[model samples]
Target: MKNDTVGRLKMGYLPLAFVFLFFATELSSQVNIADPFVLRVDGKFYLYGTDDKKPNDGIPVLVSDDMVNWSGPAGNAAGKLALAKGSSYGTRGFWAPFVVQNNHMFYMYYTANEKIAVATSDSPLGPFMQQEFRPLNDSLKEIDPHVFIDDDGRKYIYFVRLINGNRTFAAELADDMRSLKPGTVVECINQSQPWEIISGNKWPVTEAPAILKHQGKYYLFYTANDFRSPAYNVGYAVSASPLGPFVKYKENPLIRQTDKIKGTGGCEFVTGPGEKLYMFYHAHADEQSPTPRRTLFSNAIFVPGKAAGESIFQVSENKVFLKSSAR
Candidate 1:
C-alpha cells in the first residue's frame, strides 16, 4: 500500500500501469501455480502447489535456481505428477502443498479431495508416492497441510478443518510422520478479525496455516476470507507453544490487495539464492478477477511491532515476476 516501487524507480520511473505491463509479459506468459509453496534444498528451489492445470493428476512441482526462471513441472511429462493420483491418495480436488525434509526423505504434505495426506520421495523433484493411500483422518473434511518440526525434534502438522467455518488447527505427528499422535489435536486460530470477514457468509473462515518458530515464539501464519474474493489476504498469530492460545497481530493483513496485485494470500517462506528470506504467493490473474492465479515473490523481514516487546513480519512492496516455462 505504501508504494515502495515508486521510490525505488524514481530516477526513471515509468507510470505504474506501464511498469505492471512490463512485468506482466515476464510473468503472465508462464507460471500459473496457485497456493504456491517453495522448498529450497541443496541450493535449488522446488515449487509445489494446487495444480489448476492438472487438478486431478496429484500435486505438480517445478524446479528453479534463483526462485525465478523456473523449469519443468519437473517430471510431469505425459501427465506424470510429482505425486500421481493413483499412486497416492484422493480422487480429485488436489490443492495446497508444503514439503519438508526429515530423516533423509522428502515428505510432501498436501490436500486432495478436501483431505490431507503425506507422500514421500527420494528426490525433491519427486515421484512422491504414499506408503499407504489414505487421508490423515477421514472423520471430517480438512485441507492445507503444513508440517513444522521444533528444535527438540517434535513434529506437528497444522491444517484447516471445515467446521463452523474454516478454522486452523494443529496436532503432534506420530513418529512415522504419516498420522497424528492421538489426543494431540488442538485448535490454533479462529476467524476473529474484521478483515477476515470478507467472505460475507454465515461461516467465518481462517485457512492456509504455515508455522514458523523464531526466538522461542511460535508464529502461526494463516490466510483469511474466501480465497475467491479479492479481499483475501494473509495474517499471523503468536504463541509460546506450537498449539496454543495464539494472539493475532494488532496490525494485520500483512499482505493485502494492491493496485496491481489482488487476492494476496496462500503463502510460504523460503530462503532464496542469496540466503535472503522470500515469501512466495499468488495473486489473481488480473487486477479485477480471481482465477488463473500467477505466482509472485516478495522479500520478507522481521520487524519490531507497535506494541512494546512485540515482533512481527513484514513483506516488501517490491516483487519479482517469473515465468514457469513448464506451465
Candidate 2:
C-alpha cells in the first residue's frame, strides 16, 4: 500500500518536473538573435545572426535539431563568438549572414562594417576563414548579401545598395561563386510605397533582401523603413527573372506590426519539416519593448494556388503567430 502511494506521488511530480526543465532549457538555449538567418543542413537547422545582442562578439550562431529548440556552442550563447572580429576589410559591424553550401564548403556571405565579404568553413558551425579579405568589388557600394542558387544551376547574389535611399540590386555570381559576372548586375527594387515612410527614414529604406523561386516566378522579399522604427515591415515583389524587373505586390507590406507583435521585419524563408515554408524573423521582444531588443520568431507562410501574382502569399496569425508557440 505504501509503494502504491509513493508511485502515485512520483507520477504526479514527473509532469511538473518536465515542465520546469523545458522552461529552464529554453531560457538557456535561446537569447536575442537579430538579423537572423536559419539554414537547414543534414536535417538540422543552423542559425546565424548579427552580433548586435552579444557584447564584443564578432558573430554568433545557434544550432537546433528541430526549429523549436536552439543553442549556441556548448548549449549557451552568452559569451561565445562564432566568427571573430577584426578583418582585412574592417574590424567590426557584422550583420545579416546568408550561408550556402557548394563543393563541400560552406560559404557565408556577410556584411563587415557595411562592406560585403565572404568566409568559408568546412562545417556549418564555423571559425570561418576569410581567404579573400576584400569586398567583392571595391566599386560596388552594397550590403546585405543574400545568395540564391536557382534550379538551373545558376547562382545569383542579391544585395542592398545604399547609394539611392536603400535600393537593392542583383548580379549573377560567376562560376567561382564569389565574384560577379561582368555585365549581369541590375537594380531590382526600391521604396516607393506609402507605408515605406517612417520616422527615422529621412530618404527611404528597403533592405534585408531574400529571394524565393516559386511557381515559375522569382519572389523577392524585403523589409522597409528603419528597423528601429515601429513602422518596419516585410513585403514582397514578383519577377519572372532572377535578375529582376520585380513588381511590388499590390498589397505592399506582407508582415506588419501587430498590437501584440510590434516592428516585424528582416525575415528569411526556409523549408521546414513536412515541406512547409516557414519564415524566420526578428521583432521587438514584445509589444511593450517597442524599439529596443529584437527576438527571433518563426511562423508558417502560406502560398495559395498555382499561379503567382498579388495576394499569392499569405501569412497566418498576423496578430499572434509568435504567441502560437509557447517559446
Candidate 3:
C-alpha cells in the first residue's frame, strides 16, 4: 500500500491508544473499555462503544460517576442494542456507535456491514430504534459516523466515504441528519500525499474522523495507514470552516506508537463537568503479539499559544494517574 494511504487507514484507531495508555494502572483486575465514546450527563460520565473482545458482537456500555474508575464485564453489565427491524443489512456485528444529544433526543450514529445508520432514543443508555436504511450517500461505502453540532444549533454529520477507487471522502449531512445535502459532500483529502503513497500502490485510505471546533477554527483529527500493520498512526488537518479547505498538519501523524504504546488510533474527545478536555482512544496491550488485544486509554489536549491560521499539536506519553475517584 502507498504510504499516504497507509497513514489514512491507520487513522481509524491509532490515537485511541494514547488515551488508554494515559490511564494505565497497576491493578490487573480493572475492566478496560475499547473504542470508547464518552458523554457527561446529569453530573455523571457514560461511555458507549464496542468491546474489543469480539469486535463483531453487540455494542457495549460502561458507566462511571468519575472518568477514572470504569466497571463492567466485557459484555454483561449493560444491555446490547442491535439493528432495528427491516434493517438486517448488517451481516457482521455492529461496530463504532457514536451518540449525541440533540433537542432532548439521543441520536446514535453507527456503522454495520460497512454501511452507516442512525438510531434514536430518549436516554443515553438506550434501547435505540433504527430509523434509516440507506446511508446519506447511496453510492459510497460509508463507515465511522461522527456527528458534530455547531454553536448555532446547526447539526452536521462527518464520516468516511469511498470516492474514486483508492481515496476516501469527507462529507456533511443534511439538517434532518439522514441524508447528504446537495453540494455538501466535499473531497477533503486523498491518499496521495508524499508520506502516504507507498511502493507505487496507493491504498484507498481514511477512516475515523473526529472533529473539534475551538476558538473559531475547526480541527479534524483522523487515523491513517493499514489498521493491521505496525505503521498505523494518527494525523490531523485544519480548516477555517467546518466545511473545509483543510490544511494538513505540517508535522503529520500527531500521535503514534513509540516504545511504550504499541497499537494506536481511533480517538474521540470529551469535556468533563469542569470543562476539562480529555481525549479517549485504544491501543494494543502487546505490540509484538501476532494477534495483539487492544486496551482503551485517555490523554489531555492543550494549545500552547493563541494564534489564528493553523498550528500543530503533538500527542505525547502521559503518566498514568488517577484523575478522580469513583463517586
List the candidates ranked by lDDT, beginning with the highest: 1, 2, 3
| Window of ten residues with lowest summed lDDT in model 3 | 1-10
Which 10 successive residues of model 1 have the least lDDT summed?
1-10
Model 2 alpha-carbon drift over 4 Å, by segment: 1-30, 74-79, 286-292, 305-311, 318-327
Ranking of all candidate structures by their TM-score, best first: 1, 2, 3
The numbered model that scores best in TM-score is 1
Q: Write the per-residue lDDT of candidate 3 for residues 64-167, one digit (tens) a residue.
A: 66566565432221344433333323446466678877668777777766677777677776656654355444555777778777666555666777554323
Clashes of each: 1, 0, 34
lDDT of 2: 0.69
Task: Point to the candidate with the largest lDDT.
Answer: 1
Local accuracy of candidate 2 as per-residue lDDT tens digits, 50-132:
75554335667777665655655521222344566653344667778888888888888888767888887777777666765
TM-scores for every predicted model: 0.89, 0.82, 0.78
- What digit string (tens of lDDT, one per residue) describes model 1 on residues 209-271? 987666567788899888878888999999999887799987899974578788888888776
Candidate 2 is scored at a TM of: 0.82
